[model samples]
Target: MINNHMLKRKLDWDYRQRCIYMTTVTVEKRRPLLGQLTGGLGNPTVELSDVGIMVAQCWQEIPTHVPGVSLLEWQVMPDHFHGIIFVQAPQEKPLGAIVGAFKAHSTSLYRAGARQEAHLWSPGYQDTILLHRGQLANMRAYIQDNPRRLAVKRAHPELFRIIRNISACGHIFAAIGNHFLLDAPVKRQVQISRSVPPDALAAAEADLLAAALHGAVLVSPCISPGEKQIARAALQAALPLIVILENGFPPLYKPPKSYFDACAAGRLLMLAPWPHHTDRRSLTREQCLALNRFATQIAQEDHTP
Candidate 1:
């Protein structure tokens, strides 16, 4: 199951509304009792253990037990389960209650069969409530590829690891992705102001992309719209990049799919000097300026003699 380092729910969101949610329920202590990934990276498949199969069966019965819950897609991973479900409007229970019932029922079944663990799942689940149809489609693709992705990570552990206490640009950070990106001799900071016009922003991005193509590591705080657009473009072009963040990495931290793939390819380095936080954060003006300054420092420190 995904870690609940992120909040259980959106801070002020109404859980009663009709929403599409992707939830992750992890096994207690992350035991691989559910299943194993087979067929290798070439043709990955989840070979469900007996318990895994039973748990999956229980997942299928959630709708029958909980009204206003529709199961869209689900994958029972070796250590945790990922499910995409739609909670309809005018519901009898919120998303948490529905998930709680499923967990309770599954544990009962597991215990009835004389399982060792008192509980099958961890205390709570992590949820991602999709905002739009585009996000929903991307989540579907993510769930479908979960097995293959896990297989690939198993094949290459070093690239996907979270390494703490990394020293770079006279600062310490908890970092994920290729730490080696910091060593590039031609690192250039991309500092675009929010006030830049569309045309100038386009030009600035093009210049950065050209430099990236010529073996320069592009660094950015990625706070401003222009910077964000350029950063996205840089990743799309598969160039090396270093991103500065205000928040640090949490335990069992994994980057999103785009960043994950970039990390696997050793083309990205994300650095955060501050400690990790679970609460949703809004960037203060002071923090934004400080992070932008950090990008400049990171780039300057990497310049070769």
Candidate 2:
């Protein structure tokens, strides 16, 4: 039988595979020690403090000390660091070990400079393994735009607040960046974009709305006209919805008149994985398809029976 402790621990997957890795380390208590965010909305940058510069140096030196690990890209934020490390070949140590070493070295330097005995980083960093080329590209964009996203969030704290670990309806969701993950007990359904004939859009929209009205959470990027129609219907019916956005929420995101009622009723959740792009535009085919896949995955995680 799996013990509770074992069940709670994340599986130690083999880290020798050639793949892209994304990781984030936050400062304990989320103090803005590493850098300061500067600039206006859509043009924010991080000005590294003395400690921040040291942190960056430690991260840059990782490749020299760790075999088979290449630093692809990295961004230093106010209280955290986001980096993409690629494992080019099998290494003697795991990816976690490499990260641990970097964290220890950076923390040591920070403590010595600050002349304090407190922890620098919060325990246990967050990591994601990119399994596909498309994911790699998307993650690369996300990391590169971290500074700009932080700026947008600061400009509009009301919409971009990182509501961490929210529990709703027996599910725990990590609402961070612009995306949300429904950890378990997910109820999922798929509505393909541009798949419905123009004449059938009304009926398809009604069907989707009916699913949500019946307690099936509607999940989508809501990009297609038909999908948007369904989203509007869900709002009108006061049904719960999980919307995936192509861009980050605008500063002080006030829902449009159409969505205001639903949002007020606590029946809407908007999610996005990308930074806010000031030049808002239509979604690319790849982005539309990727978000649809993510919706399906969320639905599949629903184990409620």
Candidate 3:
């Protein structure tokens, strides 16, 4: 039986709709047969191995085999691949079918060339549906810059790394995104979203301040103008905050001036699930919603007794 912790993709969701899709597939056992990551901190590059070159060629040919699918940005890493695919029209096959076909073809070619019969790909993959154009741009930049981030992580694993299942204040949170660590236990955390109205923003800000007065951590993505105001207020008041970001944290990342003191006080945590992009300036609607969902999840998990 599949562990309940593993979430199956929505089987009933329609994939024929015209939209942008992102998917990631890793090699079996995460072997670094695809490429070698090299270069310095800000200018990392990927040197494709023999297998990596084949993977790239196969990825480029995905659009040719898959009807109604157009390839966007993609990257072949040391042991994984990240690609953006756009479904331009309705099709008989869904996104999963296209991915499966690509995987099968790639695996066959790889095994035949390498003279190995072992499985080439791990089971299942990670995917996301882009809701708007902003997200597409963000994802494109992210895919293009994976090697640079990987290089930095490899060079400085102690400074920039993914820490899994961190427990704070009786709550378990994973640092999969760009985040800074705070060692405080969370108390009275509240969810703040971009959709809150102006009047509601004031009330929410007041409530957040009151909660802070009573020692509560403010959790939010702070993407909207209104939500940002609350975050600014929380920073000024020296209240603990858990800010969810849309992009990955850069190497030796530090909080902004507004939140510097709070971070220094060990009352701030920033979380993201994306790799650091060198030129990301905006967040897409889909990214905002996802971060808000994460914020809500964090709030729900902060159930301190």
Q: Return the top candidate by lDDT.
A: 1
Question: Per the 3 Å backbone cut-off, how many clashing residue pairs does candidate 3 have?
Answer: 3
Residue by residue across 73-138, what tens digits does model 1's lDDT show? 999999899998898755756788878888888889888886565778877888998987699889
- Please state every model's RMSD to the true fold in angstroms: 2.1, 12.3, 9.6
lDDT of 1: 0.86
User: Which lDDT tens digits does candidate 2 get at residues 269-304?
Assistant: 666666555542777889877777777766776455
TM-score of candidate 1 versus the correct structure, residues matched by position: 0.93
**Whole-model alpha-carbon lDDT for candidate 3:** 0.70
Better of 1 and 2 by TM-score: 1
Weakest lDDT window of 10 consecutive positions for candidate 1: 1-10
| TM-scores vs. true structure, each candidate | 0.93, 0.58, 0.61
* Model 2 regions lying over 4 Å from their true place: 1-12, 162-305
What C-alpha lDDT values do all the predictions have?
Answer: 0.86, 0.69, 0.70
Worst 10 residues of 2 by lDDT: 1-10
Question: TM-score of the candidate numbered 3?
Answer: 0.61
Q: Count residue pairs with overlapping backbones in model 1.
A: 1
